[model samples]
Target: MSTSSPMRTVLVANRGEIAVRIIRSCRELGLRTVAVYSDADAGAPHVRMADEAVRIGPAPARSSYLDVDALLGAAKASGADTVHPGYGLLSEDAGFAEAVGAAGLTFVGPSPEVIARMGDKVAARAVADGCGVPLPPGTGTLTAGQAAEAAAGIGFPLVVKASFGGGGRGMRVVGSPAELDEAMAAAGREAGAAFGRSEVHLERYLQRPRHVEVQVLGDGHGTVVHLGDRDCSVQRRHQKLIEEAPAPGLTPELRSALSEAAVTLARTVGYVGAGTVEFLVLPGTSEFFFLEMNTRLQVEHGVTELVTGLDLVALQLRIAAGEPLPFTQDEVRISGHAIQARIAAEDPWADFRPAPGTVSTLELPLGPGIRNDFGLAAGGAVAPEYDSMFGKVLAHGADRDSARRRLVAALGELRVEGVPTTAPYLRTVLSSASFTEARHDTGSLERDWTPDPADRPGAPSGTAETVETPTVSSGTIRRVRIATDRGPVEVAVLGRAPRSGASASPSRRPGRESAAPGASGPGGAGAPPIAPMDATVVAVRVEPGQEIAAGEVVAVLEAMKMEMEIRSEVAGRVAEVLAVPGGPIAAGSPLISLT
Candidate 1:
């Protein structure tokens, strides 16, 4: 049975574009809105846009957005009657949702029991099986010993996944038995950090699967409808960078099956509110398996909204308010096409490293059938404590080709400065033949994509100029005064000592050079796997005297909300471990010396 209650105010328990998006919807509904922020976002735009705001905790997510007590306190203090967890952060956290309800505030999502049931990979798979939804060949949750035994039956080239993780965390593909232990270890660490769980399971790994998901909406009145399918095959390191609705080139039968399957699963779970049902499809085939269900609004939901001409957030609010189905399945109409590009604060050409800083300039694309969801304004600082995604640009048109053209043109008109972004890279992908022809798969990025070396930060061209610096002995800043037409100006200059021997540059800065060709033996003295970018060492997997094979992960570095594994380029013995977990590292700094 569903309960009906009116909500006067809503607290958006999230930070970033999603929060801004929710506030707009609440404003349209004539509802007051509250915003929560951490110390790092005290002055953020979301905080200023809401009817009321409160500081939850510190910069780290653990102390702020993920802190259930802090969020509950804010809601109570602000007298918010409802809570909207706008994707990521705590949106999918079942416990947090339960806490919000216990505090007498409605969570704009499914019940906590439903969330827990679908959020756990193991349980979700069982639910899918009972619902007759196809699933990938896999095992239930497993221990370390159980995983080994399961791997033997699953054979090589299997994926180990955290039973209670999402967004690609706690997942690893093991090609052989030798790599199983290391993969499990890395997956465990990432799983623990991402979801606070270390338990994992095994599954058969598909080499070239296309990721397709359906946007599902359900009201407590037993009405569930799918908003159609989205093709999210374009990704980097398992994180989606681009998404589109009505998955290109999908057969009508297949599309119907996908949608029907999603609705079936939602009805089986008695799902309520906004949710996403994801699937993995084998390229060039209609066979697809249930991947997982996200029990909240997705980041790419705007694309579906555009194609379907509906406000998902508004629907979520109505459902949570005990409203019945606004329309029947046959009444739902999906026309045209829509695409969304995730503009992240990172340099695509530089291993997609985080490039957080102040936004010196901002220019948004404006035209018919175009929308840019963002929280950034000129002079706003993009903090490093949160996800690197700063905005999303979406476009719609009467047809797929038209939509693609509009999206590409809009991306070209978009401009940003003071930090590198994936804008240019996204444009390239949109124009690539593989994408236009809909031939790309999940592994397309690793196999066929390469960043343009010339793509720089999103800054205006012809305005950048180089300045020469004088050699200095120390790394401290010195004050200097310059005369200007208006008045005298003061500037601070930091100095750096030249690298020894290699005065031109630090190409061979000690302990960084590769081994001489023809060298042989365990102590061959090869160049170590250096830090690809400045990041925090989240995990070190190797130790001195440990033997590792080529392609083995030696350490994991985290930057800009993404993780990169530093792997051995050649088989050798670990000679030294220079970095430890929680340590800061500079680009090109040796992490593990190999011999």
Candidate 2:
């Protein structure tokens, strides 16, 4: 009888890696999936993987994913019965959920009312307090004079938070009255940019606290289950770079207390579907303070799944379809330690800004206990229009030490050749004594640490002075063009899925972008990887089979964008031709190979 019922079809109103992650889960549960993308993402990995894809609008996220009409239109056109707002953008938008539900399509998340309530940090804290859950010592936002009074009562170190904040965007720490106003202004501006409204709240700031969160799953039937906890203290600029489940230093009693607090909050609101309740753990002290609730799936949910042996995305599907909570409290247990590191298309040396351009080489580590939640592929483009994260490298181990060591080894072997990524930076942090000993806090990344030689990619002599954006013309096809420091480089992509090995055989197809030739000659300088910034190969002195000594200059390339030369770090004979002149290239494409 159940088989006769109509099948489930979900329209994913988002793009990038999360879209791919969600689609994979929907597939395992026998659901047909539709993907919606902006003009910029027509060739994105997510679009190609879906059964059907619809162009919602232009490149900007607000005009597309956050656009209610566009999302609804795509769902209707694709015959979608549900809309899965995969984290960020419209994920927590109550209005979007209401719109989808009004259109008679299920929203694969919690109720609209629940989203609204959880969004207000003030209200969320109130609920936690009411339910006997311990909370931070700060009340709702008060008048400016009241704020000063409250600050005094809460003590000097306190946090001013935007009522609607995520990604640590609208938070300011004030240590004294002199810094309070400035913190407020910065918090308000950032909050407005990220969440639109700038309403603010207050909380006492605990120095050196560890950021921890619990994953909660609930069904409308009143049964809610907790999927352990994740330690998310490894950060830079308040953005998490590494996360792990079954936190390293937590005692059994502490874990139970934290998990119960998360479960209690869900039951308080009759919450439905997947959500995370975050808290700030005072490391030395066993006590923790309630931070806020994320009413949507988090970016780090994979760690929880690895430790608990549950497919959260699949669980979301079952819950959205009105299924009961599959397991009881006793049944849900953390089996092992799991760790995840975000591999972003950004330069850690450059204040962690997004490094957007073509991806010449895209490869990931594969083995036992490894899981990759990725977005980019070879020949795909990384745009400044969205986040820099290309994927997350996750590994599970029987214990914390094994997980950390295995994770570090996997990261060392991982490579993304096109744009600069945080892979090398991740390795540095993982091997550090502080991290290895499990001593970490929210401020660890910002603390002074000697930069490893490997961590620093030498400053270019020069590159990318003037940027030229390349364009391709085709009637009726809207395109996204990027102006690189180099000359205009045209990239035409197939948004539709390739026949599995299309990229591997790109050489046969020809005309795709390739980097300038590598440098050669004295000083044992061999240009190993060609820099992507626009420049001319002013000089290519190395030939095939040339014996190169260490630190020799193999090539001298000029990027009128900026003029620069690359030297090989390895000592060997030239093995192959990696780049060609008069062609565009990106960072890390092999220019020369040495024996």
**Which of the numbered candidates is closest to the native, going by highest TM-score?**
1
lDDT of 1 by residue, 198-220 (tens): 88899999879899999999998
Residue 544, model 1: lDDT of 98
How much lDDT does each candidate structure score?
0.79, 0.73
Per-residue lDDT value at 443 in model 1: 86
Residues 301-390 of candidate 2: C-alpha lDDT, one tens digit per residue: 999989888888888878888778768888977787999999887656534535566787777888889988888788887765566677
**Residue 160: error of model 1 in Å?**
1.6
Model 2: residue 243 alpha-carbon error in angstroms: 0.4
TM-score of each: 0.85, 0.76
Which 10-residue window in model 1 sums to the lowest lDDT? 500-509
